[model samples]
Target: MPVTHATGIGPVPTAAPKLAPNVLDLFSLKGKVASVTGASSGIGKEVAIAYAQAGADVALWYNGNPKAVETAAMLEKEYGVRAKAYKCPITDSAAVEATTAQIVKDFGRLDVQVVNAGVAWEAGPMIDVEGHDEWKKVIDIDLNGAYYAAKAAGRVFKSQGTGSLIFTASMSGHIVNIPQMQACYNAAKAGLLHLSRSLAVEWAGFARSNTVSPGYMITEISNFAPKDTKQKWQQLIPLGREGNPRELVGAYLYFASDASTYTTGADLIVDGGYCAP
Candidate 1:
């Protein structure tokens, strides 16, 4: 028998070595379910898709988007996941409670709840802000709506023993913007962040909670800014551009899934270094 030093090892097995448990796998959301408020369009729509792609069944609620049915269909078809759309307005506590019940009935369970439905006023100073009715409308829709959604989700999560509550806050919560003013919107988002952190602490034992503070993300809402204004904003950011709404997916995913098992009460900022300086 000629033994060659270059001969392959004799102990080769028929199978590949098992991979070490991945944090990524731990982060997976397969078989879990999520409910996304304001999912008719914008970031909410994108988050719904992202959740589906992550192996979750999704329930999307919209206040007024007739197209939401199509969005629901798309999620189901694309991700091979169960998807549904509801017409729920977050400003109505009773409505939220009812809608949440419907979601649970349809989805079988809710593991993640994202409170992303919010409204903003046209950019301008406070005094020049159209009229009293407008100011109240913005606050009611933005601030109070978040409270209702969080409360409704909190109730279900408490009953279930484990869940994640996420809020869609903004960088405006930390720093006020220029050229255009959104005082009411700023205040509302600031309230949302604090509320999330407080809830995280209060719900520490059974559920996890967090918020995503996106900075100048490019979206239909951002189109209100003029070309020059947007250009100026880019210069302010160290990364030289505004973040896209899709960029917000990772933060929410971490909070909504098992990946952030040890994380809570955290504000994951996706501001493209705009707040760095």
Candidate 2:
């Protein structure tokens, strides 16, 4: 008889199954299908490409950028893998659920879901901002949006008995940034850290949950910061520079692949030593 967890899910294996002898093979996502939100550009785009190169069929989800469609076409052609783009506004829970289900239907199965869609909080300090609109928007997309994706994907994972959920959290989740007042963004990301960990336990019998907290990177999301503000950021970072989006793809890939089968409820920080000090 199989054991059941508190969530009423069946038992997970007690021992590791026979895996490929070659270490590299453990990282291969061949025969897997992944969906990535915010895949129009920046880190999301890079991760989509990395997934394709690693042999996973990819569904690129974008809300405002049509470039994802072209990128999907390129991936399908160059990597000889199935790729497609979907217009998914993660802020809408119903839409997120529908899109996730569609991806499973389209790809035949959903193996990994990356909740990467988010916007930077631009309105200055909370006290100075007019009304609560900005705060709510950030919370809706950054925190609530992730929950929508996780809930939808978690259902699929439970049904399939296996899946990986990776959230694109930020260093703001772990440490408060100096010289910038983005309490909303920080709060949202911090919430994500706990949310992922909570789900890691709740869904342990069927899936894994983890977060990737990236520091200041050269992405459009940070374009709002002025030159001097960024300079201050570099000074604070021990590496004296911002990270490239490509540099963070490995962490996302690891969490999405067989290489991290035993890992869950973890946050991998790629912050160029900023949080180190």
Candidate 3:
């Protein structure tokens, strides 16, 4: 029988260098089109701005958040990149698909999709929280919505043979938060981490998939937590401070640009050393 070269049974072909000659060139997203969900405020808003600043036209998606329209305008005016806002109900798979298709239609191509729309558990303990409905709300937006977005973006990526998919997971996904019972939220994020890893392998040939699991950040979402609770977090965090939303932009940017072409299924945690211990 002839020797098989596919499994290292014979001479192996050397891989060609794929990175740009200049290091900065690898990070440029010029001419690319990026769509980010939950872009009205917080980390999502910052991420959209960063993508535009990196030279990519941006599409902002929000669920009933009209401020995203203004944010879109600001991005275009500030970065000189074409930007628009879409009211997308990410919880609905069909709505996500339609919105993604519309973005591609308006932009003429798709390059990056950031699934950052998520909600925190507000009902306190899981035992006291209203059953089914409350849990459903978090799971739908946090986990299922991410799945929907990936499905829509994966289609475009497959066709183009290139794309970037970034999910805004959380440090809670890696370790349970203290003094707060957010079982549903934690589970959803943990699931997202695994989902991204699975999709990374599945879409290896066409695109790259990764996650940015931020720790407690100074965002509107944190406002829901009691002041005392936040202080507790600061003490637990090794860095002794919460992160800023703008601080997360660099992680997402790296994943969205050519700089991370060889990186996939990676979970970059930016939680002010919360998980370091």
Candidate 4:
């Protein structure tokens, strides 16, 4: 494939590599093994589905939602791939490492890892965002969780020499919002974007790493917000509506597929123009 190509387009192939593998094959995850954190709900669940649709065996990690067990079954049935679910606490580094080890051991190989599990503490300003009791918790899960996942996934990627790592960031990482305050959320997400980019550069020549920053999506997570609050969010999005969790499937697919073989250290914003303005 040509080393350089058009935007959002896969690399152009002039002739097949002499001894190197077909880089186009990099886009196909068939026979690959994938692990996704926060696969129990919202964007996480859809990400797992997209990977499965790409033809990879999957290990889903969830902190809550007994439905994760069902999600696993459904994935296996629908995608014809082996699927397993584990309840994991990404906030704990050791636990994350151990669980990731178990997944690789069980699956025989771990090719893709998606750090999608995160929490947002809601309130007024940063001070009110999270009290002493909750402040640390929010930072721990949102920011620290990404670190743990990256460390755990990077280990396997480094060893294998070819893997994909995906981080779920937010449009909030780029722009601040009004009406409802979530300063802590914004800070954590912003950190995650850079973290993914740093890892991408560090892991270059061995593995691929990228971040997907999504805007306000309509999911069970936001279903708890008041109607007027959600409506206000719609007004903020240039699409004149909140995004659906499923809308992010295509972006996730591109990052996880060979379509982005030559791409790394980049931010794929599937924010429906929320960050465009």
Candidate 5:
């Protein structure tokens, strides 16, 4: 039988003073299984390696880059962790679901999932974006792709009673970038920011959802911009330079491990003070 309350209001309870016995251990991902999309190169690749270094078996997903196969082997050899690569298109909802299920099957369980697959906006501003194909392609991969990944992993998380979902948003989500007109990219990222927050509430008590918004990084993705444009970005950044992919490992690792057990609906901006001023 259910206990009945004498009054509609209940007394407020005092907050518990709980802390980890070993704070450093909180950052360890030992024995956990993680998956990262867009692991073929750039930030995703670095994040995959970092998770393995932290002792988590990882599944790296790449859309077209065959290099991830070798990278997966490298991760296993270097970190002594289980790592594999899957060729799947994030834009395909069914494919994302199938890939995620395979990872859980192969690894026994899924602990962390990083939905980092994305594409750059090749068109100009929204006015000059030309066709709907341009915008559709961006949204399909960046926004919709994230949604599909979350939906697939959320099921596993709910079943396990605990999990972590991390998305690679961008500082562009927070601010309109200069020297380049990527309205579609910014909009998709901004949508992702809110998507993560919404999932956090919806999945509360079962899993945590968060995003890592990186600033201008010195990755191959930025190779398209000219030297003068790159120099302009350096001047705008308070740190006087673009960030390295390695610098973002800590943020991803924290969100992927026990260190952020109580952290959710949060957006960690790893932009070298770009959004500060």
Candidate 6:
């Protein structure tokens, strides 16, 4: 007899579910409800648009920029999908929980959640930094915020018996970046990688957890860096250039769709092969 566990825990599956014979169909997000944090612009905005284009109703979460509202409207008009912008401060655990719950309430069900909200550590080396405030802020948003999202979303996934959780980690998590001093950012992202993996095992019976680590993407987050700094980044990247935000969406799409059903506890790095060398 098969051993039994809690509702959202195992009895691990013994067989794979039959998939659509058409490979493309597996990539479709029709009728699915997805949510992306940090969706005001850059990588988050691009992912939100891509999800809408693929037929998922999306909730775009933003903290400060109101551009997300306009983006949502554009998605509705252009993609003909239900899309809405929400103001959510990821640093606040209560806000994160409430916002996530609100998305499920509005969308009826949430199939995918991408916790991509984060801040870059512009403050140079940790030791020379003025205060602990900067370090705490980075940890609060990048690491703690992600954990809050997983807890809130994990509950819904457990109840619904299915969901996908994706984190926007950084290549810095895998390797120490040169020409830049961001110990806090690196630590937070490294924590994210392990957090996702741990959640994958914990939520395996009902949901999947994964991460996408992008390297030197041309996003607003990097605007603080000088051109020469970026030039240094380009030299380290095997592709010899910074990646466009749009270029990283394919990995996000794969993790959000049925195409990655069997892929959990994984980190898909779209870093222009920077980590290769």
lDDT of 6 by residue, 1-277 (tens): 1234667565657357577889899999999999999999999999999999899999999988999999999999999999999998898889989998899889899999999999999999899988799999989989998888889999999899889999999999999998999999999999999999988888888889999999999999999899999999999999999999999999999999989989999999999999997
The C-alpha local distance difference test score for the whole of candidate 3 amounts to: 0.91
> In candidate 5, how many Å is residue 56 off?
0.3
Task: State the lDDT of candidate 5 residue by residue for 37-118, as single tens digits.
Answer: 9999999999999999889999999988988999999989999999999999999999999999999999999999999999
Model 1 residue 187 distance off true place after TM-score fit, in angstroms:
0.6
What is the TM-score of candidate 5? 0.93
Residue pairs with colliding backbones in model 5 are: none
Provide the global lDDT of candidate 4 against the true structure: 0.82
Cand. 6 Cα-lDDT = 0.92
- Which is the winner by TM-score between candidate 2 and candidate 3? 2
Q: Report the C-alpha lDDT of model 1 over 1-277, residue by residue, as the tens digit.
A: 1122356543222222243278787667898999999888888988998999999999998977867789989988888999999998787889999999889998888899999987766747899755687778878887898899888888888888778999999888999887678898899889999998888777765677899998888787787788998998888889999887899898888888777777878998899987677
Q: What are the per-residue Cα lDDT tens digits for candidate 4 across 1-277? A: 1244667475444332233266656556788898999999899898888888889888999986767789899999998999999888999899999999999999998888888898765655766443475677778998998899889888898888678898998888899876778787888999998988888767775788899998888777665578898888888888898888889987887787777767788888887788787
On TM-score, the stronger of 3 and 6 is 6
Each model's RMSD to truth, in Å?
A: 12.5, 2.5, 3.5, 5.9, 3.6, 2.6
Candidates ranked by lDDT: 2, 6, 3, 5, 1, 4
How far residue 92's Cα lies from its native spot in candidate 5, in Å, is 0.5
Q: Considering every candidate listed, which one attains the maximal lDDT? A: 2
Residue 195 alpha-carbon offset, candidate 3, angstroms: 0.1
lDDT of 3 by residue, 1-277 (tens): 1123777574332233377799898889898999999999999999999999899999999987799999999988888999999998999899999999999999999999999999998877888865689999999999999999999999999899789999999999999998778899999999999999999878876788999999999988778888899899999999899999999999999999988888888999999999999
Structural similarity to truth (TM-score) of each candidate: 0.90, 0.95, 0.94, 0.89, 0.93, 0.95
Candidate 2 global lDDT: 0.94
Candidate 3 residue pairs in backbone clash: none
